[model samples]
Target chain A: MSEEHKHTNYMRIFWILLTLTIVEVGMAYTMQSHKALLIVALVTLAFIKAGMVAAYFMHLKLERKTFIAIVCFPLILAVVLVIGLFPDVGFKLGGKHHHKPAASQDSGHAVEHK
Target chain B: MSSVALAAHPPSQEKEILGVSSGKMAMWLFLGSDGMSFMGLIAAYVALRIGNWGIWPDPTKVLAIDLTAINTFILICSSVTMVKAFAASQEGNVGKLKQWLFFTMLGGAIFLGVQVYEYSQLIHHGVKLWDSAGRPAAEWLHPAIQGHSTLFTATFYACTCFHGFHVLSGVVYLAFILIGVMRGRWTVNRIEIVGLYWHFVDLVWIVIFTIIYLF
Candidate 1:
């Protein structure tokens, strides 16, 4: 009941989200050449905006710590899932072998070799 | 027997699991699972893009960044309105609650409309779910992709369309809640639950927009 009565400055959170979004778009355009840096910056800004919304707007900040811990479980799994895929997809370990046939076709070597 | 049970344990003594109402806890659980689904889609997108890093078309070159940025702003505005509605409900202000809820729904509707428009434009420019011919008519498409698979457009359509459907569903869900409010059957807890769903939609979009459009 005490948590329910807590005050949240929804407008302030709104402004922060708005400002972060503006900065995201501006960085997207200005830092396109530095692809890695741009991705890190934009993703960081996005997470900040999302965290603010969840905390202030959704009132997760007012909830019990146990409830917050419960919510974090799936999010942690999601990060794990992404990182697990890095070796296969991101590094393309066996990808080149699989792509060989298609690469040959693209280079017109398939018809010539046949 | 029910009356005896109720008398034994008054409403105030009812157990609250982790200090959350059952309804709100259920909503949070659902949001968590739903978030994992979106994460799956996003992970697939990242995998495809990385696997074909050299040939994957630059998103900024193909997608309308400015339009989507504006659309993102619209969605953020709607999230704010949704929270405002919840606050109004907490205050027991029916009139203000209804007003803010209507605004939130309007924002979602506008967002969906813009998404449909963007889809149409992309389709006109030759983006398809699966191009059997293996040639999308987009000139900006890489020469290497002319005769290969259309993973770029395919993943783009899949991710955006799924999110668009969520927005559409959210609008309809809010419409039902708005009807309930009109009939004087609304509760603060109910409004708060729906607001959680709405805000989660906004949250998912924040990630998708960055990974899909801005990345």
Candidate 2:
């Protein structure tokens, strides 16, 4: 009985993953107009697919909460790392006023390389 | 202890680090720490990209997304086969275990093959590393990619090549395990450990595909 149950579950998960991939690819073209929306949608779908792989294929879903915590703890640090970069990632924030466009400084830096 | 005594006194579930075998627990810990490495690469990529803002290459034109989607599907199938291999091993069905293990390895090989082909195509299109001379003077280059070839190519190679290296190692590891199975030296537990690694590779690819390709 357990064998049959696992077989069905694996099959189901595979189909779901395949469908999600198709949908994500399809959205790649159709969602071009709304860039922000497309990124959010793509990331959400990818996370769902990743969740399926981890929970079923890796058998994390059947594992104990402690295992899940072990898996998730590093991810929290990862998130914090990304978040830490955001303040200086693209926009101008308070600093030493040394932020200049790479193009504008090309002449000065180009001489050093030469 | 006799086999009977050992069998009767399996490692205490409560004391075995959340009931998982130490080996499995160690694998999970390694994956956790390794996950941070990938996160670092991806975060660096994203930061550089956001810094560049609108000038970053449009991956749809520069990358072979359709081909990679097919590759992603192949990897997903491989993950499925890996799970099936584990199930067969647990059932003590050596034949199915060998079959599924071979299929999983084949999937990894195909993925690596496709990646090599894609890299060759990109190189022909003038995508390369360490050449700060910018995009090749080739007329075939995508207009969006022409000015930004260095950053795009460098990050692309860094992120994907690292993942590709993982896939290569995975295929090699799977082959070793398959040989063990053939020689009747491997147990179901060993296969499960390798499967854990394989599944984690697939999981990382999921994030890479979204961030690098689709986004």
Candidate 3:
């Protein structure tokens, strides 16, 4: 009944999401050799699909700007937290570099750690 | 401190914050915090996967991508049904609302069922939360990755199982909402709130399917 909900075409958004999902799965299968490109493509497609669901299905786009900002603040922080931790974890900096020597020594043996 | 200042800023009215009902605002806040928890799990998974790099088995080889891709489509359809339910509620079409809500719950139930099946198959194939000492790793695992089976198994189960739990919870949540609708005890606003939660579950799955299963 509200003006905000009037123009929403839920089916249209559904079609878009479905198409993107198909593309994502297709890319996953076809881009096996291009690891970097596949990761970028899959992540990008996932984010776009997520954005559409949030904006349309959740009716977030119909909400007030302040409310949208409130919802997004935590999301932005989540992205930052992942990216910020990447250097430390992804690269195995700090004492994690020590894992290499032990791992190499173990070779075929199962290295058990708690 | 003056009477004019007091008059200019008279007692604030008890109104909806952020132009939305307090209940809806609270749901958003809960979701924001919930999203952060999932992000933490995802970040941990990524860190572990990247740290294991070469030893980290290809996810597609370990996971059933075709089945999961179908599951992803089902979740997306459920999301659409959820929104349709909300739209019907807003239109005062109780019959349509009930129908769509039931469909949405059905979709969630199917998704959960498929997840349970997948988990069982994986477990039957020797994948587990913790690999026992001296045990040979699952055959599907990369041959060179000796001790890292636990890392792969743990992170895979943790992420997927957590999301599966959310799907189960969402189905139960929608069941209650559907019951409320049947009894004529629910409001359009409540439908919208539940719809937000459903859509969020779908959104989280979209990301997980890509990062965990596809990647």
Each candidate's TM vs. the true structure? 0.85, 0.88, 0.85
Query: Candidate 1: where is the Cα deviation over 4 Å?
Result: A1-8, A93-114, B1-15, B130-149
Number of clashing pairs per prediction, in order: 0, 0, 0
DockQ for all models: 0.55, 0.54, 0.57
Give the docking tier of candidate 1: medium
For candidate 3, the TM-score is: 0.85
Which of the two candidates, 1 or 3, achieves a greater TM-score against the reference?
Answer: 1
Model 1, position B196: C-alpha lDDT score: 95
DockQ of predicted model 2: 0.54
- Pairs that clash in candidate 1: none
Query: Per-prediction TM-score of chain B?
Result: 0.87, 0.89, 0.87
Q: Which candidate has the highest DockQ of all?
A: 3
Per-residue alpha-carbon lDDT of candidate 3 for residues B53-113, written as tens digits (9 for 90 to 100): 7768777776778888889889998988888888889789999999999999999999998
Which lDDT tens digits does candidate 2 get at residues B1-215? Answer: 58677665554322367877777888889988888999999888888787776678888878889999999999999999999999999899999999999999999999999999999888776566533556455555645587763577788889999999999999999999999999997766678889999999999998899889886
- Of 2 and 3, the candidate ranking higher by lDDT: 2
- CAPRI quality level assigned to candidate 3 from its DockQ score: medium
Predict model 1's lDDT versus the native: 0.83
Candidate 2 chain B least-lDDT 10 residues: B6-15
User: Model 2 segments beyond 4 Å from truth?
Assistant: A93-114, B1-3, B7-15, B130-142
Which candidate order results from sorting by lDDT in descending order?
Answer: 2, 1, 3
Candidate 1 residue lDDT tens string, A33-104: 999999889889888888888888888998989899999899999998887676557665334444465454
lDDT of 1 at B209: 93
